[model samples]
Target: MSLHESVLCSTLPSQGTGTLTLHDLQTGTPLALFKHTSSSSRCVAVIPTRAGLGGVAIAAQVDKAVLNVYSFQKDQVLLKCVLPERLACTAVDKRGLLCAGGTAQGRIYLWEKLASGALCNVWDAHYRQVTTLAFSHDGDALVSGSDDAGISVWSVSRLLDGDAQNTPVPLLNFSDHTLPITDVVVGIGRFPSCRLVSASVDCSVKLWDFSTNTLLTTFLLPRPISHVVFDATERLIFAVANGPEGDIYQVNLLRRRDDHVEAVGGAGVNDIIRLGMENKNEQDPASGKISVGEEVTVLSLSLTSSLLLAGTVAGFVHVYDVHSHQRLRSISVGAKITNVYAMLRPPDLFGHTSLVAREGSIPVRPIAPLQRTRATEWEGKEVGVLLAPFGKETAESLINYPSDELQRDFALLLHTSPSNVREEPATATNARVAELEAEISHLRGQLGRAKGVNDAMWEAMVRKVVAQEKEKNNADEGRIKKKGKKDH
Candidate 1:
C-alpha cells in the first residue's frame, strides 16, 4: 500500500450481530469493522509488537467471560483467556502483557502469552472494579485507578515472583479522591524519579511526586476530567472533561509561578503546598501576566506527546498542534465516539493495540457514495471525510456505505488487480521494470528540492510502484508462455 493508502481505514466484514466499527484516521475508511460474535465487548486495548509493527486489540466479552485477542495480520482470534466473570477494563503494556479488572468483583488478573501460544496468569487483586490501568515506561510498575477513587502502584516483578497462593502488598495506596479516580499514569524518566498522575470524577487531576510520597500539584479542571495525559514534552499535562460545551486543557507544570509552598506534611515543612495556583487566571510571578482558560479535558495524548488528541461525547476528536496552541484538525468519528484512544498504529489496527507491522497490505477499494439523509444533511450525507494527518489535502476518502452498497463494492474491488508487472515478452517486461525503477531513482533526486513530503512526491512514488508491479506481472507471464512452448 502507498503511504496514503496504508493510513486509510479498511473494514473487515464479519457476520456477527454485535459489531464494533473503527474508521481509519488517515483514509476515513473502515479498518477491521466488526461486531462481537457472542456479546458486547467490555474492554479493548491495542498492543504493538515486533511480530508486526501494527497493534493487536484485545476485547473482553461480558457474555462469554473470555478475552479475544486479534492482530491486523489475521482475521482469526490470536488468543483467548477465560475469566471468572466479566471484565470491566483492560490495559496492554508495551511488552504485550494483558491485564484485566473484574466488573462486579474487585480483582485484577495478569495474563502473559506462554511459549506454547496460550495465555497464562489467572488471578486477582484489588477489592473493587478497576476502571483504569497503566504500565510505567520502564515496565517495572503497573498502576490502576478504581471506582474506590484510590490509585495503587504495583511492582510487576514482584507480582510475577508471588506464588499462586500468596497475596501481595501494594507499593503505595494513594487514596484521596472524594469521587472515583478515572485514570492513572506513571511519569516517564529514569528509575527512582517516577511520578504519578490521576484523574478523578471529582473534577481534578492530581500529580503525585512518588519520590516524595506527596501530592505534587492539585489541578482543578473546568469540568470533571474523563482522561489525562502528558504532552509530547512531558512538561505540559493535558486533560479532558465533560461540560455544557466541549473543551480540552493543557497544564504547564514547570512554571515556578505557582511556587507558594505550604507544608502539608506532619511535624515539619516536609510537604510542599502550591495552592491558589489551581486556577490559571492568577497572575504569573515571572512574566507578571494573568493567564486564563488553561484547563482542558484530555481525551488522548500521542505516545510521544508531539500532538494532543481529545474527544468529547459531542462526537469530535480535536487535535491540537501542542506548542502552537493552534487547532491542527478535528476528526469526527460520527456516532457519539465515547472513547478516543491513541494507538501507535492507525485507529483501525485489528490485531494488537500497537502500530508496528512488517508485511501485508490490506487493499481497500472505495465503495460508491450513498445518499444523505435529512439528519445527516448538515455534512451533506457524504460517505467520506477529510483527514488532517499533516499537510492539508483530501489525502484520504472514507467509504461508509450501507451494507448492501458495501457488498457490491467489495465484489467490484476484487476484480481490480494491483498494477505491477505485465503479461508479455520477458525482455520487454524487464525493460519496462528498468524504466520505472529509473524514474523512481530520479524522483529521489528531486526530493532534495522540497522541504517536506509534499503531494508531488507522493504522486510520483505511487505511480512508480504501480508501474513496477505491472512490469513484474509481464515477466511472470512470459515465463509461463515459454514453458507452454516446451510442452508443445
Candidate 2:
C-alpha cells in the first residue's frame, strides 16, 4: 500500500457534476476520477492518515454546510465522515492525527482522528469565516486565517490534550490585512522560529514572526493575490494574482534593495517578477489567447522546487518550469479547476517507502534561531524612525536646496537673502545657465513625444466608437428590411 507521486485536481463540472481526478505526475494521465453525487463538491485537502496503514483523508465540501471526509485507499472510499458545518477552508496535520476546518459562521472546528476512521472532539475557534489554514511542520501549532483579515495560531497540544469541552485560546493573533486572507503557509526547518506567511485580497502578502506577534515584512502586488506557496528552499514565494489577466509571479524573499527601509512597520516595496507566460503562437488555435483575464484559482509547487502548477478558472492547469519560467504543459480538465495538490512520494525509510507528503525534498538552509531581545530592540528603533521628523529646516529651504552647499548654508541661514551673496565666476555662471537651458530643451522634447502618443490613443478610441455606431446602424437597417418583407 505504498503511495505514489500524483496530482489531485478538484473540478467544478459544467453539467451538474463534480469530480476529483488523480493524475500521475510523470505521464499526466488520469489514474482515477471520483465523481460525486453533488454537483458542487470541491475537494480541498488530500492528507495521509496516521493509522500505520497507507491511506489518504480526502476532505471535500459536499455543500455549503456539509464537509464529506472520504478515507481513500486503493482508489476507493473505505470510510466516510460528514461534518455538519459550512466549511470554507481546511488543513491536516503532518502526522495526520488532527484536522482543522474553518466555517462560514467564523468558527473553527478541530477534529481528531479516532481508531475506526471517525472524527471526534470538534473544537470551536475563531469569530469569522475561516478562509485558509496550515499546520506547522512539527505538528505542534495550527494557523488559521479568516475573512475578518485576522490570523490565529492555536497550540495543537492544548487542543488535543485538555478536555474537549474547553475552548482553547490562540497562542498568537495577527490582524494586519484589511481584506479576506486567501492562503497561509507555515515555515519549517530553517524557519523554525514560528514564521508564517499569509496572502490576501488586499493585494499584499505579509511575513509574520508568530513567536512575538510581529510582522517582519510585507510584499505588495499589482492585483489581489488569490494563492501563495513557498518554493522548495523557502527563499522565494510563488503567488497567483486574481483577475482575467492574472499572472503568476515569483517574489524573492531574501533580496531587498538598499533603498528599502529596514524598519519593521514600513514594508520594503519591490516589483513582482512575472513568470511562466505560455507562448500564444504555440498554443491551440481553438483555445485562443487564454481569455484576456482568466483568474488563477489555485497554485501548487513541486517537491523538487523546479516545477509550478497553476489552476485557472478557465478549466486549464498550467505546469511551469520554475527556473526557466516556461510553461511545460497545459492540461485541460474540461471543467473549472478549483484546487490542485501535488502529492510527493515519501522518501524511503529503512528501504520501505512511507506515505506521501506535500512539500519538496530540498534541504532547508540553516538560519540562526531568532533572539527575542534583539527583535524587541529592533522594533523600538523602527518605531522611533517612523515617528522621527524630516528635519528642522523650513519648507522653502528644504524644497529649494539642490546641492550640499545650498542645503547646509541656505537651510541654516534662512533669514539671509540670496541677492546679498557674493557672485560666482562669470564662466561658471554661464555654464550653469547653459546646463539648465539644455535640461529644459530635453524636457520639452519628451513632452512633445508624450503628446503624440496621447493623440494617437484618442484617435484610436474615436475610430472604435465610429465603427461600433456603423455596426448598430447596419443592424437597424436589416431589421427594417425584414419587417417590410413580412408586411408585403
Candidate 3:
C-alpha cells in the first residue's frame, strides 16, 4: 500500500514481437499490456516489489535463451529464465533486491535470489555488447555499459564476496569512450556514494565518481547520445539526440564551465540546460534544432511528475516540461521506442489480464522454472560449527587510515537500529551481528562468483545441448550416405 500512481514503462525492438507498455501519462492511456514480449533492443526490467508498492518484478522481453518474469502478484506471464547468454540488458535493484543480466557474450549475470532462480555473480564484464546495467541507490554498486567503449564499476559487495584475497576487480574501468556505451545514469547516491552519468556514441557525456574512481564531469553534446535521463533534481540531464532531427539535450549539472567547447577526458566542463525541444524557433545550443523525429530512442525521468519522458525511433512518446520547456503530450506507442519507464506503477500491476485476478489483488510469487536450475548447494549445520579460523588471519596489517577515516569506519559498520523496535539495540545487536558476518562472507563468495555464474551458465547450457546432439548425428550420417549411394 504505497507506490501510488505515475507510470509509463515501455520497450520495443521489434523483429516480430514486442510490447511491455504501461503508459497513462495523464491521458494518452495504455495502462497495461505485456503482449507477446520479444523486446530486446534496450532489453527491459521493472523490479519494484518493495521500494514502493509491494509487488512487481517484470523483466519483460527476450527470446533466444528465454526469460519472462512479469509479476505484480502474477496473472499470465509466469516467470521464465533459461539463459546461457543472449540477454543484452536489464538491471534491477532499487530496493527490489537484485537482478541483472547483460550478455551477448560479455557476461555479468548477478541474481541474488530472484525467487530462487539463484546464481549471484558472473563476470567478464564486457569486451563488447553489455550495453548498460546500472544500479546504485544503495544496491551496493554495479554500473556496467559496454559494446567495448567500456565503463565498469561492479562491487556489489565485491561481487557477493570474491576471494583469492578479495579479487573481484572493477571498481571503475572507464576507458573514455571511443564510441559505444550509450546510457548509464546511476546516482541517486547511497552506497560508497554515487554520481555516474555516462552516454556516448562518442558525442560524450561522462561524469563519474562511482565511489572514487573519479572523473567528475564532461558533456560535449550535440547528437549521438540516444538515451540518457536524470531529472527529479539530480540536477538535470535529459539527453536523446540521435539522428534525423532527433534533438533534446539539456545537461546542467548545476553550471561550472571554463567555457566548454572541447575537453576530451580530463573531464570538467558543464552547464548545458537548453532542452526545450520541438523547434521553438530552433534554439541552437549547437544545432540541436529540436524536432523529435528520425530516431531519439528513449529517456524516462518522471520522478513523480517532473515529467520528461521522450522515446521515439519514430513511434512517439514526447512529453516534456522539465520546468516548462513545455510540450506535455505526445504518446503514440506505435513501435520503435526502445525503453522508457518513468517509474512507480504498482496497482498490483493493474490487477490482472487475460487470466483474471483483480478483486483485492496481491498474491503472485511464482518464479523459478524456465529451465536451468541446478544451483542448490549451501550445506549449513551453521556451516559446520560457526567457525572462523582461516589461515594466518589475513595478515596485511599496515594501516594509516583516512579515506575519510575509511568512509567513517564504513558508515559505522553499516549502522542499524530501529526496526520497529521494542527492544533491539545493543547497537542493533551489533549491527545484526555485523549483518550475519556479511552473510557469511556472502556465502563465501557465493561458491566463487555465484559458482562462476551458475557454473558458466551450466557450461553454456551443456555446450548448447552437445551441439544439438552433434547436429543430430551428422544428419544421421548424411542420410545413410544417401542410402548408400542409392543402392549402387
- Cα-based TM-score, every candidate: 0.57, 0.60, 0.30
For candidate 1, the C-alpha RMSD (Å) to the true structure equals 23.2
Q: What TM-score number comes out for model 3?
A: 0.30
When 1 and 2 are scored with TM-score, the better candidate is 2
**Residue 16 alpha-carbon offset, candidate 3, angstroms:** 43
Model 1, range 201-281, lDDT digits (tens) per residue?
A: 888878787666767667666567676777544576666555544445566665543657333222212333233335455
User: What CA root-mean-square deviation does each model show from the true structure?
Assistant: 23.2, 32.1, 29.4
Q: If candidate 2 were superposed on the true structure by all CA atoms, what would the RMSD be?
A: 32.1
Please provide, for model 2 over 13-48, each residue's C-alpha lDDT reduced to its tens digit, 9 standing for 90 to 100.
666756777676655776566666222222376654
Q: Which regions of candidate 2 deviate over 4 angstroms?
A: 1-4, 37-43, 49-52, 69-76, 114-124, 163-165, 190-192, 256-293, 345-488
Give lDDT per model, in order: 0.54, 0.62, 0.64
Q: Model 1: residues >4 Å from true position, as ranges?
A: 1-32, 37-42, 51-54, 62-64, 75-80, 98-102, 114-124, 256-298, 344-488
TM-score of 2: 0.60
Model 1 lDDT at residue 28:
46
